[model samples]
Target: MKSKILLNLSLFALLISSLGTSLHAQTYGKNGMVVSDHHLSSEVGVSILKKGGNAIDAAVATALSLAVTHPEAGNIGGGGFIVFMKADGDVTTFDFREKAPLAASPTMFLDENGEIRDNSNHKGLLSVGVPGTVAGLYQAHQKYGKLPWGELVQPAIDQAKNGFPMSFGLYRAALQVSKRDSSYDILQNFFRGPDGEVVAPGELWKQPALAQTLEAIRDQGRDGFYKGAVAEEIERYMKANGGIITQEDLAKYEAVERKPVKTTFKDFEIFSMPPPSSGGVALIEIMNLMEEADISKIEFNSTAYVHLVAEAMRRAFADRAEFLGDPDFNPEMPIDHLISKDFAKSRFENLDLTQASKSDSSKFGQLYGGDHTTHFSVIDKDGNAISLTYTLENSYGAGMGSDKLGFIFNNEMGDFNPVPGITTSTGQIGSDPNLVAPEKRMLSSMTPTIVAKDHKPYLVIGSPGGRTIINTVFQTVLNVLAYDMRIDRAIEAMKIHHQWLPDRILYERNLLSPDTRDALEAMGHTLIPTTNIGVLMGITYDARLRAYVGAADSASEDGAAKGY
Candidate 1:
């Protein structure tokens, strides 16, 4: 362990210095590509492809590497979903989303007065669900990987062991952690030195403990994380903290294979994550609503076009609030009826082009999700494409890390409705469908999507933003297919989000001209200005050119898209 640690440090110092100097904006690429939020992670995917691994193998490598390099959100200590398409046209979804422990109750986060409890739901170990990333990656590899699982995981192990230079984004996240959860475990255990100073950009940061953990997983598969020493560490951490996770929860955790939600928009057939993730249903619904409106005549991002898209977003998110949840927990949800053309037409007709509809006014024709997620898109030469999105929910999730193990835990429990009846502070009605239940998977806004035309992949896209994920993805698709924007332009374009109850349009400050914002306001739209909502990454396949156009969001300076 000691020798490996020292060797890792030396190698990391040499490698990061070389790579760090080359850090700059990456644009479109073809042949084979991996587009991710971090350059190192993207390179890891590219290396896998060069080694003869397929898109699935490259995606797993990128995901693991992100967990080490982009620790604020990317995670092995949390869970997420993977949407995959094989060259033969087979499509599937793997949901390794975290689950509520058996010991949990719907009202666990509610106080004696039946009010929602603060901090406990999202700031401690109780918020950490049974993580499924390891299992999810293993399951996907078992079915589609061209390389051995150990090989796919090694790059991340080396990254964590050898350390990497801190990027500005990660440095900012660390500073935020210091401000909000300064007393949190991460500060004391890993992110900070004995002097209590956070690591800054250009500094070498290593995770010897995380490296050891990754090695264990590489050797023992799922059991390495869920059933043995790692599990004991988790249990030990929870017992010492105020968490409720148990050895049983970790030992019994399983990643399930679910059907990808499939829909058609114009010339493309879109496949995305199913329930447990509200993304697919909502994305389809938004697309359907847009299809009903003749917005193609309007300029993209013009006042009129933005208004139509925002209204569609409002309607879809309203449905998301009322109907979506864990299928196992809510068996009566009208999954088919919600995504049907007839339902979408009715919702679309309810919208008035001249005015906005109150979120409360949308009748529950019934559908839908939130998360601070990370997404990566990979397209290999064999035509296999994987769009995977995962998260640790919130930057430095739960603001806590294990002293023994060296990764932060997710605050996904915050995704559930703390109070099942009355509406809470966020404006949406109190959520019942997504209320906590023992062993129930939490609702998610992660939409790892693939769009195909003529049975060939046209675009692969997804993003990371808490509630904005669905809309960021929704608008990006429209920007490309409808507005005919290039893949890079589509991702880099300004974005907007509306999650129903707030009854307000949140948009990127720079994207919408002041006149457009004024025009929308005149139309009775409540506008809130902000920076970019989501950090999107994607790759568009050009069959005619037989190449891939890998694109990363311009808003994310650390993002990269590499090809060879």
Candidate 2:
């Protein structure tokens, strides 16, 4: 068994090296591990673990650091969810998903003609949601963190104040956002150097303003961001720009502790974020449907396997569009029914193994979400694990940032259904469950999940892909638990997505052979080729090695798995 484990480790390292990038190799540690899309952030997290901080402490520190190093998605100006699992199996979730402002209404994005105006729902100050990252992190730390709050935040402040070398990924992202939306002077000033050129890769990019903001948070905890100086600055910016967010909206924001959605797949218990994230419910629903089949009997990524999984995805996503939303707003959302094994069985009963299911948009709402988000996974020696995903919706969010605040704001308002009754074949959903309302969190596909066996964490995993997030996580979990693949191999494996409304299977380019593609098409499945699906950060506990093994998806240009 030890030799086999060694062989598997060797194979994993070989695969990493063969990826043709300077990516970090699959990492292993007896004490702790952190896997994220940025090497610096991963190192910061591992440093916290070495300081005797638990997984939660490491998570807070890691997230804070990413806000400095990886601005594309890692953000204090955004919000997300956290799925936490203690070694003894106690599980909980924190919902800090950005909320619609008090002044937001169902048709706020519509113009005089009742159509979306200037893409207002996704483009400017009006698109920004109430920030929640600071509140969520602080709340989690207050309850479970062992390190000083100041200590966790200090690293981010230092990174921003002292500056860090800009990576090619960061440089490219900054350039892309600037070019995509040239109207935001804030973004232009932030990305451009003294010569009026975009900051080049490897240059030391400093953010003194962000550092000052972090310093306040470090000194005052949650109130630092939500109540005093930062809140006032945010209000001033909004009012000056015709945006609606106010000091009251910022002050009223609170991250809520909620029960995690729990379900069993074979011998493993899965825990993930619940509603206002459709992730957990949809993931379990898909898994439960897949559980009915002997997946092992079918070859991985074969036509038959893809068909079965896509069918499952189709049915689950249909349910997600119709029934899932913020639990606070839709108390009767059939949570139990949606995740139940019986429900999955019934859904699977209608799945034709040889035919593709039609995704009628009229029957289910279309998904409107940004494909840019960040996820990190951490586990300490004590077996505590955290799977957290956050985003500034649509890379760099709203293409705007505050020179005074030094952080971008989330355009998360776009996640809400914009029109009241406008479900369209072109993939626009007007589902009432996700309509904008005061303080209502928009529905999300950010599924931070932990899979456990025998009351200990076995796998901690998540990804960043908007509507594809749930499916990406679903496939990864299945890759490990069902197909018996190592965590690294599971992450590197090709992925596919099938959201209900699109009625198409999106497969990673070049993975599906011509024959397989032909076969799928023969079954009436519309196969669309795409680039990498998600940048998955995952860690698994190797019971045989009595250690944690981590993997950062090869698709991620700057991702790393750090451990100590």
Which candidate tops lDDT?
2
Model 2: worst 10 consecutive residues (lDDT sum): 14-23
Clash pairs detected, candidate 2: none
Error of 2 at 139 (Å): 0.1
Report the CA-based lDDT of candidate 2 relative to the real structure.
0.89
Candidate 2 structure quality by residue, lDDT tens digits, 128-181: 999899999999999999999999999999999987766666777777767765
Candidate 1 lDDT over 349-399, as tens digits, reads 778989877655333322223346789999898888999999988876777
Please identify model 1 stretches exceeding 4 Å from their true place: 1-30, 179-182, 193-197, 361-371
Name the top TM-score candidate. Answer: 2
| Model 2 error, position 397 (Å) | 0.7
Regions of candidate 2 where Cα sits further than 4 Å from its true position = 1-22, 194-196
lDDT of 1 at 119: 59
Cα error of candidate 1 at position 443, Å:
0.6
